[model samples]
Target: MNYFQPKPISNFNATIDIPGSKSITNRALILSALSGKTITLKNILLSDDTQYMIKALRSLGNKIEYNESSKILKIIGNKNPKYDNIDLYIGNAGTAMRFLSSYLATGTGTATLHGNSRMNERPIKDLADSLTQLGVKVEYLNKFGYPPIRITSSGVWATSVKIDGSKSSQYISSILMAAPNFKNPIDISFIGKVVSKPYIHMTLTMMKDFGASFTLKENSINIVPKEYNLSEYLIEGDMSSASYFLAMSLISNSTITLNNFFKNSIQGDSKFLDVLLKMGLTILDFKEYSITVKGTSSYKGIQLSMNDIPDVAQTLAAVALFATTPTKVWDVENMRIKETDRISALKNEISKINGDFIEFKDGFLINPKPLEMYQGDFLETYDDHRMAMSLSLIGLKVPNIKVLDPSCVSKTFPNFFEEFNKIYRED
Candidate 1:
C-alpha cells in the first residue's frame, strides 16, 4: 500500500540516464531465444516484464544468464524449446504475452500462456485467431478473445495470413516473428489500415538484424521461413522515458543530457524530438548517442497526432497542458486497450484540476490553462505503469499529488519514484 506524494519542482537540471529500452530488450531476448545462436546483449532493462520473459524462456529449457553488475545478458539458444507442460505467467507485460504467444505457437508441446488478472482482460484473440488460421491449435480457457488458454503447436502452417492490422501491431508482430519459423513462408495482409506502423517496422528491423529476410508489399509482408542467427546487440536507451526528462527540460528550463540513445533509432518515439522542436525547445545532438535539450521561451501549444508514439501519449498530453496555448492530439484510439483506458483516466483527473480538455473516441484536445493542483488526494494508477510515471511529470508543477498503488511502476520503470524524486524540488 505504498503511495507517492508529488513534490513541486522549480528548476530541473541537465544529465540523467534512463535504463535500456524495455521494447528493445524484450525484442532482443525473444530474438536471442529464437536465434539458434549464443548472443550477448548489453545495457538491458532488468525490470519485471523482462524478468517474466526470462523466467518463461528458462522454463522452456533455454539457458539465460543476466549480469547485474554490467547489465549484460548472455543467452544460449534452444533449437527445440522443451516445454515442461507448465503454465507460463507473463504478469502484465503485453510484449511478453504477445511475443510468447507466437514463439510458443512454434513449439512442439502444448503450453499455456496467460498473465495477471489484467492480462486475461487484455484482448489476445487477434493473435490467437491469426495462429488458428496458421494451423496452430489455440483455445481459450475462459473467453474467445482473452487469455488463460492452451496453445499446441502441431503441423505445417499457412503459406500466408490475412491479419487485421488496424487493431494492434503486437498481434501482427507476434505472427510475423513466428511466421518465419513456420514450415511455410507467411504473407500478411491488413484487414483495415494498420495502426502503430512503427512498431511493425521495429519488429521487421530486429528480425533483419538476426539474419531474417522479408519483402513488405503495399499491405503485406512476405517472408520465407528461415532461421534467425543472433549477433551482439546493444539496446538503445528508452527515449519513451527520456521524453519525460525532455519534457521536464521544456517546462522547467532544464538542460538534460541522455546517454546510449541513438538519434537514428528504429523506435518511433525518438521522433518526439521533432515534436519538442516544434514546441520551441532547444535540442542539440553531438552524436546519435548523446543529446542535450534546453528549455526555451517559445513554448506554444499545437495539435499533434501521436499515434506512432502511443506509449508517450500521457506525457505529451501533460506537456501540452503546460504549453503556451491549447493543444489537440489525434490517432490514439489504440491506446484505449493498453494497461488502462488512458484517455478516460486522464480526463477524470484533468477535470478535478479544473482543466479544459475534450475527449474523443480516438483522440483528445486540451487547452493550456492553470488548473487546480493535487490536493493530497489518492491518485489511482489503473494498474498501468506508464499512467503512474507519466503523470509524475505533471507532479513537478502540481503539488500535494499522492499516487496510490505506487509500486505498480515495477511493471516497467521500477524505480520511477526514485528517479523522479532525484529531479524533484520543494517549490
Candidate 2:
C-alpha cells in the first residue's frame, strides 16, 4: 500500500485557487450535449469522475474538445443521439451513471450503462422507476434497483412524475435535466423530503442557464420541453474541496484564503462556511470572488443537521476533533452509501487516533480530543477521496501521520497533495 506522509507544520497562511465544481461541470456537460450546438465551459475540472462523463458523452457521438492545460471544455451537443446498443462504463461516478441513464433514456437507442464493482452497488431504481413513468423502458441487466442496467426508449413524453429523493437528489436531477428533452412539459413531484435540496436547485439553475424554462412550486418542478440555448459558461470553484482547507485553517490556528469562490454559490457545501462561523472561526473579509478565514478563537462543538450538505460530513468529522466539546452530526444517513461506508470509515479512523465517537445509523457524535495522538500509524483511506482528503487534516497538527491510498483523491482533486503542500509552511 502506498502512503503519503506530509510533514507536520505549526501554522499556515496561504491562498489556494481551488478547482472548478465537479457537480456543475457534469451538469454542464449534459446540458451542452442536449443543446446540439457548441458551448464553451471555462475552468472545468479534469478528474476521474468528470472524465467518465465526458468519455461517455463522446461514445454517444457528442463532439467535445478539451484543453487540459487551459482547463477549457467545448462541447457540440447532439440533439439527436446516434448509435444503438452502445455500451458506456462510468467507473464509480454516481453523477455520470445517474445522469447518463436518464439522458440516454430520452433517445431512440438501446444503451447499456455499466461501471466498476462499486458503481453497481449504488442504487438506481429510484431514477429508473421514475423514468419508466415517463414512458422510458428501463431494465436491470444485473441486480434489481442497481446499475449495469439497460434503457431502451424511442422517446418519452410525460407531463408529471413522482420520485423519492430520500436516498439521493441525483435521481431527481437526472429526471429534471432530461425533462427538457421530453416531447412535452414535465412535472417532477417529490415523494417525500429531499435529501440534497441544494443540488436539485443547482440543476434547476443550470437548466435555466441553457434556456430551459422551469417553474418551482412547493414540492414539484415544472419544466417546459424546449431546446437548450447554447451559451458560454464559467464554472465556480469547488466548495466541497474548499471545506478541507477551511478546516485546516481552523485546526492549525492559521488563516487561509480561498480564491474563485462565490458568496452566493449554488453549491450547498458552501454552507460549510456558515457552520465554521458558528464554530467561532472569524471571517476576516469576504469579497465577490474570494473569502478569508482566520483562526481567532477556540472552537465550540455544536450539533449540525447535515442532510443538505452530506459531502461535507467527513470534513465536519475532521474538524470535530479540534472542538472543545462533543459535536453531534445528524440527519446524514446517506453517507453510509457513498464511495465507501463513510460513517464506519470515519469511526474506525477516528478510533485509531484515540478520538472518542459514538457511531449511529443516522449520524455520529464526535467527542472532543485535544489533538490526534501521533503514533506513526498508517491511516487507511478505504479508496474514498473524501475520506483521504478530510482525514489528512490531522497531519497539519499531529505528528507521524501517514495517509494510505492517498491517490484516491484523483477521483476529484487530482493534485490535492500538491496544492496542500503549497500551503505547508515550515517554521
Candidate 3:
C-alpha cells in the first residue's frame, strides 16, 4: 500500500487556487445536455466524478469536448436520444448515480447504471422510487434499493410526485433537473425534512439560470415543462475543497490566500468559513472572488448543525483535534450513506491519534487534545476522497503521520496534495 507523509512546515505562506465545485459542475452538465443548444462551460472541475458525468453523457449521445489545459468544456446537447441496454459505470460518484438515474429515465431507452463496490452499497431507493412514481420502469439488478439497477423507460410525463428526502437531497435534485423535460408540468413534494437543503437550492438556481421555469412553495417545487436555454456558464471554485486548506491554515498557524473563491457562494459548504471564524481563524480580506485568511496559534471548539453542509463536516472533525474545548456536530445522519459510512470512518480514524471521539447516531463529538499529546503512526483513508483530504490536515502538526491510499483524492481534487504541499516552506 502506498502512503503519503505530510511534512510539517515552520513558516507557512502560499496562495492556492481550488478546483471548481463538483456539485455545480455535474448539475451544469445535465442542464447543458438537456438544453440541446451549444454551451460553453468554463472553470469545470476535471476529476473522477465529473469525468464520469461527462463520459456517461457522451455515451448517451451528447457531444462534449473538454480542454484540460484551459479547464473548459464545449457541449452540444443531445435531446431525447435513444439507446438500449447501455451500461454506465459511475464509479463511486453518488451525484452521477442519482442524477443520471432520473436523467436516463426521462429519455426513451434502457440503460443500467452501476458503480464500484462502495458505490453499489450507497442507497438509491429514494431516487429510484421517486423516478418510478414518474412512470419510469426501475428494477433492482443486484441489491434492492442500491445501484446496478436497470432503468427502462419510454419517457415520463408525470405531473406530481412525492419523495422521501431524509436520506439524500440528490434524489430530489435529480428529479428537479429532469422535470423540465417531462411532458407535463411537475409538482415535487418532500416527505421528510430534507437533508442538504442547500444542494437542492443550488440545483434550482442553476436550472433557472438555464432558463427553466420553476416555483418554490413551502414544501413543494413546481417546474413547468420548458426547454432550457443557456449558451455559456462559469462554475465557481469548490467550497468543500477550500475547507481543507482553511483548516490547514488554522492548524499550522499560517496565512494563505485562496484565489477564485467568491464571498457569496451558492454552495452550502461555504458556511465552513463561518465555522472557521468561530475557531479563531481571521479572514484578512474578502473580495468578490477571493479571500485571504490567517490562522491563529490557539483554536476554539464550536457546536453547530451540519445537516445542510455535510460535505465539510469531515473537515471540521479534523480541526477539532486542535481545539481547546470539545467540538460538537450533529443533525447529519445522512452522512452514513455517502462514499463511505463517513460518521463511522471519522470515529475510527480520529481514535488513532488518541483524540477522544464520541460517536452518535447522527454525528460525533470530538474532545480537543494538545498537539504534543496527539500520537499516531498511520491514518487510513478508506479510499474516500474527503477522508483522505480532511485527515491529512492532522499531519501538519502531528509528526510521523502517513496517509494510506492517498491517491484516492483524485475523486474530486486530483491535485490536492500538490496544492497542500505549497504550504510547507522548504528547509
Candidate 4:
C-alpha cells in the first residue's frame, strides 16, 4: 500500500482555494445538456467523479470541451439526442449514474449504465422506479434494484409521479432535471422524509437558473414544461472540503482563509460553519465570497444532528478526538452506504489511536481524552477519500500517523495534500 504521512507542525495558516463542488458540476452538466444550448461552466472541479460525468455526457452525443488551463467546461446541450447503444461505466459516480439514467431515458435509443463494483452495489431502485413511473423502461441486468441496468428510451408520459426520498436526494434531483423534457407539466410527490433537502433545493434552483420553473406544494413539486435558457454558470468552491480547514483552524489555534467560500451558497455542507461556531471558534470576518477563521487555545463540544450535511460527519468525527467534551453525531444512517461503510471505518480507525467512541445504528458518540498508545501504526482509509482526508487531521496532534491510499482524494480534491502542506508552518 502506498501511504503518505502528513508531517505535524505548529503555526498553521494559509489561504485555501477549494475546487468547484462535485455535486454542482455534475448537476450543471445534466441541466446544460438538457438545455440544448451552449453553457460554459467556470472553476469546474477536475476529479474522478466529475470526469465520469463528463465522459458519460460526451458518450450521449453532447459536445463538451474542457480547458484544463482555464478551468472552464464548455458544453453544447443536446435537446434532441441520438445516442448509440453504448454501455457507459461511471465508476462510483452516484450523481452521474442517477442523473444520466433519467436523462438518457427521455431521449431515443438504448444506453446501458454501469460502473465500478461498488457502484454496481449501490441502490438505484428509487430512481429506477421513479423513472419507470414516468414511462421509461428500466431493466436490471445483474441484480434487481441496482446498477448494471439497462434503460430503453421512449419518452416520459406520466403527469404525476411518486418517489421515496429517504434513501437519497439524487433520486428527486434526477427526476426533476428530466421532468422538463416531458411533453406535459410534471408533478412529483415524495412518499417519505427527504434526506438532504438542501440538495433537492439546489437541483431546483439550478433548474430554474436554466429556465426551468417549479412550484412546491406540501410534499410534492410541480415543474412546468418549458425550454431551458442557456447561460454561463459559475460553480462555488466546495464547502465540504472547507470543513477540514475549519476544524484545523480550531485544532491548531491558527487562522485560515478560504477563497471563493460563497456565503450565500446552495450547498448543505455550508451549515458546517454553525457547528464550528457553536464549539467556540471565532469567525474573524465573513466576507462576501470568503471567510476568515481564527482558532482558539481550546474548544468545547456539543451534540449535532448531521442529517442535512452528512458529508462533514467524518471531519467532525476527527475533530471530536480533540474536543473538551463528548461530541455526539445523529441522523447519519445514510453514511453507511457511502464510498465505504463509514460508520464501521471510523470505529476501526479511531480505536487504533485510543480515542473513546460508542457506535449507534445511525450515528456515534466520541469522548475526548489523551492518547494512550497506538494499536496500529498506520491508519486504514478504506479507499474513501473523505475518510483519508479527515483522519489525516489526527496526524497534526498525534504522532506516527500515516494514511493509506492518500491518492483516493482524487475523487474530489485532487491537490488536497499539496494544498494542505502549503499551510503547514515549519519552525
The best candidate in terms of TM-score: 3
**Candidate 4 Cα outliers beyond 4 Å, as residue runs:** 371-376, 425-427
lDDT of 1 by residue, 1-427 (tens): 6778776665566466677889889998888888768999999998999999999888887899889999999998775465756789988888999898778877788899888888888888877888888888888999778988788876447887778867788888887776667777778877777888888899899899888988978878898988888669988888787787788778766667777668788888888878988888787655778887788744798787887888888888778877878888899898888888889988877666656779999989888775453343556779888778776666667776667787887876777677676665322
Question: How well does each candidate superpose onto the true structure, as a TM-score?
Answer: 0.95, 0.97, 0.98, 0.97
Candidate 4 positional error at 59, Å: 0.7
How do all the candidates rank in terms of lDDT, highest first? 3, 2, 4, 1
How many clashing residue pairs, candidate 4? 0
Candidate 3 lDDT over residue span 51-140, tens digit each? 999999999999999898999999999876687899999899999998888888778889999999999899888888888898999999
Superposed on all Cα atoms, model 3 deviates from the true structure by an RMSD in Å of: 1.2
Clashes of each: 2, 0, 0, 0
> Compared to the true structure, candidate 4 yields what TM-score?
0.97
lDDT (C-alpha) at residue 307 in model 1: 78
Candidate 4 at 237: error in angstroms? Answer: 0.5
Give per-residue CA lDDT, model 4, range 261-373, as digits (tens).
99999898998988988887789899889998988777887897888988899999988888788999988888887888898899999988888878998899999986444
- Tens digits of per-residue lDDT, candidate 2, 123-229, equal 88888889888888988988999989988888787788999999999999998998888888878899967898899989988888789998889989888889999
Score each candidate by Cα lDDT: 0.80, 0.87, 0.90, 0.86
lDDT, candidate 4, residue 94?
83
Q: For candidate 4, give the lDDT.
A: 0.86
